[model samples]
Target: MRIDSHHHFIDYSEAEYPWIDDNHAAIRRSFFPEELKSVLDTHNMDGSVVVQARESLQETKWLIQLADQNDWIKGVVGWVDLCADDIEQQLQELVQLSPKFKGVRHVLQGESDDRFMLREDFRRGISKLAPLGLTYDILIFEKHLPYAIELVKQFPTTAFVIDHIAKPVIKEQSFAKWNEDIRKIAEYPNVCCKVSGMVTEAHWGQWKAADFAPYLEAVYAAFGADRLMFGSDWPVCTLSGTYSEVYQLVDTFIAQLPAEDQSKIMGETCVKFYGL
Candidate 1:
């Protein structure tokens, strides 16, 4: 099965999603499973792992509800207050709701603290995931790479996938530091990387497929096909280009690998990582 491992479904309401203000007019409206299903079908994708766009247990529950209704949605990477006093209880409650709840993620990219992932409370929360058979999605920018490396090291048995290949700065065509950090993080066998959200990081209007080649090459070199998975980033990706365009970017790159290696990056790796 071909899996879009890291996309989101946003049923936008100002009260529910204050983050989608005038700044993001393109995706200010709702984007539900039905909408994504069309795109997936057009691309001949088998299913997707719907990730959380907002950080709330309410929204996470909402996603579980969506997954419950949509057979095409293979899994969900929802959010919970990992630092909450009753975090283990909260996660247990969520897991009980649906077997599709495959993992957890926080918008670590939006936080000001570079070392936020290493906080004792957060680490304690992450420590609870392995026992529940849930994975953790590391969502952060390039600057947080070192902290992510340290965070992953602390939980050697827990599965962690890096969202958006750490979101390299492709618009400016910068990669030296990001590449180095990615290579370091890929050293850990427990961690994996997603080839998603590249278009948004590039010069949105002017980005060509070639602009992503170097970054893709770097990640492919570091993670290899076995530890890499494909993601479209969907509605956010539409800010720069269509879902097909985003899919094509990664699809074209992975096509270079042997067929078996291509199969792993496209879906098998995600299935194993999230137990989907």
Candidate 2:
């Protein structure tokens, strides 16, 4: 099946997306599965993995409900308080709700670099998830790459999907340290790269398909087709481009590769990584 491994949903009545607020007028409204399915239908995408945007159990439950209602939603990578004392209990509660709950994520991109990944409690919390057969979706900017590298190394048994390809800003075209860090993370067999969330990193309003090529090339080189996956980052992606536009970019970018490799990056790898 063709899977958009990374996509988002928003229910303004349910909870607040603090980062978005009124600042992101373009995507301030609700983005439901019905609308998303319309885009998927257009692109011939069979399904998607709805990822978490806020750190709320209620939101996680909401995603599960969405998944249960929509056959086209293949899986859900929701959120829970990784540092909470009852984290294991919380995950147990989540699992009872739906088999589609494939993994968990933290909005680590919003935290300060030094303490985000290496803290004692956080490490303890992450270590707990692996035993539960859960994958962790890592969301961070360039500065957090080292922590990501370290976290994946320390928990070699855990499955990790590095979100947004470490949020590379192709418009700025800044490579320096990010290039080295991504390569290091890719060295771990347990880690996978999700080609999502970059459109907003570019000039936002002026980004073109070509703008993301170098960053894309670097990630493809590091992870190869086997460990790479595609994600739409929908609703959030609207900040830079429409779902069709982002999907088309992925379609065009990998057009020349062997069809089998393209199949891996576009869907097969995600199915394996997220257990969808």
Candidate 3:
């Protein structure tokens, strides 16, 4: 199956999603599974993993409900208060809701503290995951990679996938620092990388496919096809271009690999990583 491992479904309610502001006006409205079905069909994708955009357990529950209703939504990477005192109980309740509730993610990108993932409480929470057969999605900027490397090292068995290749600064054509940090993180066998969200990071309107080549080449070399997967980032990707445009960019890049390796990057690796 061809799976887009990292995309989101948003039902825009101000009370439920206070995070949406005028700044993100481009995607301020709701984005449901129906809206995405056509795009997925057009791209010849079989299914997708709907990732959490909000940090609320309510949002997680909502995503699980969506997954329960839609067969095409193969899995969900939802949010939980990993550091909550009753986190174990919370996870138990979530898992009971649906088998498609596959993994957990926190928006580490918005965090001000660069070393937030290394905090004892957070690490303790992450330590709780492996026993439950859940994976963690690492979402952060290039600056937070060092801490991510440390965080992943502490939990050698817990599966982790770096979202948007850690959101590198492709717009400015900057890569030296991100390239070095990503290479270092890729050294950890437990970690994987997503080739998604590149268009939004580049000069949104003016970016050509060529603008992403160097960054894509760097990640492909560092993670290899086995550890890499494709993610559309969907509604957010629409900020720069259509879902087809983003999908085509990655499809073109991965097409260079042999067919077996291409299949892994497109879907198999994601299935193995998230246990979908």
Candidate 4:
């Protein structure tokens, strides 16, 4: 199954997404399954995983409802307060909502504490996920990679996928520190990565496909096809470019790989990772 492994649907509001300041006015509105379905069809994507934008249980349930209504949404990576005392109960409630509820994501990048994932409460919550058969999505900036690396080490049996290549500083063409941590994290067999959110990290209006070459080269070498998957990171990515542009950036870059390897990054790896 050809799948867009990472993307989001939002009932956008400034109150819900405080990260959207004046610059993100482009996407200051709702985006639902109907809108995403058209783009998926155009790209020949057989299905997608609708990821959470807001860290709300209500939004997680809403996504589950969308998955119930839309067969094209093959899985969901919803938000849950992983630091909560009742995290296991929260996950249990979501899993009961639908078989499509596949994983959880905490916006670790936004947290001021550099070692937020190391907090006992958060790690305690992470422990509850794998027992219930849910994976964790690592959403962090390049600086948080060491914490993420430590995180995966503690839970070797639990599956984890790094979103947005950990949001590296591609626009500045900086890579040494980011590359080091990325390669280190990739050493863990249970961890995987998404080739998503690159455009937004580049020079928005003028970014060429070539701008991402170095980062791609680093990740492709470190993670290989088996550990990498494709993600559009749409709407937010639309702040810089179109979904088609994002798709083609990744699609064209991997064109030279052995077809089977290409297939794995494009979709198969995602299916197996989340059990979609």
Off by over 4 Å in 2: 13-15
Instruction: Quantify all predictions' global Cα lDDT against the true fold.
Output: 0.91, 0.88, 0.91, 0.92
Q: Mind sharing the TM-score for model 4?
A: 0.98
Between candidates 2 and 4, which one is better according to lDDT?
A: 4
* Candidate 4 residue 97 C-alpha distance from true site, Å: 1.4
Worst 10 residues of 1 by lDDT: 16-25
Query: Order of candidates by lDDT, top first?
Result: 4, 3, 1, 2
User: How does candidate 2 fare on TM-score?
Assistant: 0.97
Query: Candidate 3 on 241-270: residue-level lDDT in tens?
Result: 888899889889888889998999999999
Candidate 1, which segments miss by more than 4 Å at Cα?
Answer: none
What is candidate 3's TM-score against the reference? 0.98
Write one digit per residue (lDDT tens) for candidate 1, span 1-276.
899898888878888887787867888898888888988899889998999999998889999999889998889999998888899999999999999999999999988888888889999999999999999999898989989989998899999999999988889888999999999999999999999988989987689999999999998999998899999998889889998888888888888889998999889898888888
The superposed Cα distance between candidate 2 and the true structure at residue 267, in angstroms, equals: 0.5
Local error of candidate 2 at residue 70 (angstroms): 0.9
Question: What lDDT would candidate 4 get against the real structure?
Answer: 0.92
- Give candidate 3 misplaced runs (Cα > 4 Å): none
C-alpha TM-score for every candidate: 0.98, 0.97, 0.98, 0.98
Q: Rank the candidates by TM-score, best first.
A: 4, 1, 3, 2
- Worst 10-residue lDDT window, candidate 4: 12-21
